[model samples]
Target: MPVRGGDLHVGVWEPEGGGPAPPTVLAVHGITASHVGWAELARQLPGVRIVAPDLRGRGRSRDLPAPYGMPTHADDVAAVLDHLGAGPVVVVGHSMGGFVSLVLADRHPDTVSSLVLVDGGMPLLPPPGVAPDEMAGLVLGPAAERLQMTFPSRAAYRDFWREHPALGPGWTDLTTAYVDYDLVGAEPELRPATRVAALGEDIRELVDGDSVQHALDHLRRPATWLVAPRGLMDEVPPLYPDAARDLWTVRYPAVRMVPVEDVNHYTVIMLAEGAAQVRPHVVEALGEAR
Candidate 1:
């Protein structure tokens, strides 16, 4: 792990072997999620050199001011690109990270030659008449309060994740070691270095989007969308939309939105099977991008 030095420094992980790797794939995790979320995705992607950045105020790059919205994230990403001495790289982002990716392509098209949006990127028509702050509260309340709960020991953390709704059957098996990798104390609690306020700012960006669809329409790079199947039965929060994914034809014309199965919000990229499914698609995109 390396942290670039600057007002907009971001953390990065580069796998070994340097034979002119494919354009670095910048993996930006969703709200509050550290670069760790892409741990499994990165490991399976040895064919390409990839870097996952801790957005502005999240993870180890917590130096930026508040209101780290789409443009802010885009700028931070561009800065990270310049710092790495890499440009025109392909970007792969999940959930809120996808929104930032869209913004990146919109605002800094020269920095990104291609974009892969996993489980996000389209405009969300939140139920009618929902107030902004209330919607924000609904979307980010859990992370704001820190759902990465502390446990008496590492085993307790592993036990709790096995039953966690957001995780899948194999998440525990894959993440148990990764989550505890940086633990320090005797209790060995799982803790993230990401910040909460940064998460709130990210929610503010999503909920406050001036028509996220309009923003996404400006993407100029090659783009692909991988959507996780989501509906009422699997939805957790009571008020969030449970509608089946609608036709995105009105948004991204060149981008394809494909459904990914057997994976939820977490396991989609955090587990081996899910990554295996996506790895080939990404390789295809890399070939196209090149």
Candidate 2:
């Protein structure tokens, strides 16, 4: 789809059987992920059209230049909706994509009828004075480090993820396809498609910028935040820890937070178990929109 900077590659999944147009849902991927991240969830919702874009610096859009941040991503999403004539659709975002969803709702409210934030969009403050690069390192950990390394083969890349603490146990065909789509080059020179510079800027904005805060402050639409029990590393205490979750609840009482058990940040929308929990919420949101 043609957006402001360039043509963004989008993955569109329509209902299996040909029928009257079903309700639309604009699904957004995480910081380092692409549209393929939504494949598992899309398979479960046969009654909806799921449109996901490989955000400007990830997947097929890796060649897109700099100036990446939440606001720019929001504009791109709105452009996608306009191009597809799918406005007022339910917007579902996972991880950093959740932050993008909130900004989209704030900047282009008419394009979004409701929001489902899957383990993101809420505030996450880094320790005071952490540099942007350092913050990226802290937040993304191995996910960031992998971008700097080159893999000898696609199998090697798969092996790398197979050992990932969060993703390893939940690996499936959908997850494999998602990971395979992230690789850009050929043997011995293969690297993840996510642009490091764009990722750094996005991470900085996620922690330091006031865009998310402002979006949360002025939210007038129905929004639900689903939190996983673990972090990206599959460690105890999720990204939205108790203290953080409590503060968010007090601050944004209107945004409901639901705890999803037995899943980490990655599996929240990347695997079948997690998608099952998320599907009903998405369905309810879509039904309510009518």
Candidate topping TM-score: 2
Model 2 regions more than 4 Å off: 127-134
Q: TM-scores, in order shown?
A: 0.81, 0.96
Q: Which stretches of candidate 1 lie over 4 Å from their true place?
A: 1-16, 147-159, 172-174, 181-192, 211-214, 231-244
List per-candidate RMSD values in Å.
3.8, 1.5
**What is the number of backbone collisions in each predicted candidate, taken in the order shown?**
0, 0
lDDT of 1 by residue, 1-290 (tens): 23233465354556566666555788888876667778787788876777777777765566556657777777788877877788788888887888898888787778887878877666554565867667555555554554445556776756655665666346644486545542333565555445556666567556547535555666577777776654212354222133424446443567776767766666677877678777777787778777
Q: What lDDT would candidate 1 get against the real structure?
A: 0.67
Assess each prediction's global lDDT (C-alpha) against the native.
Answer: 0.67, 0.90
TM-score of 2: 0.96
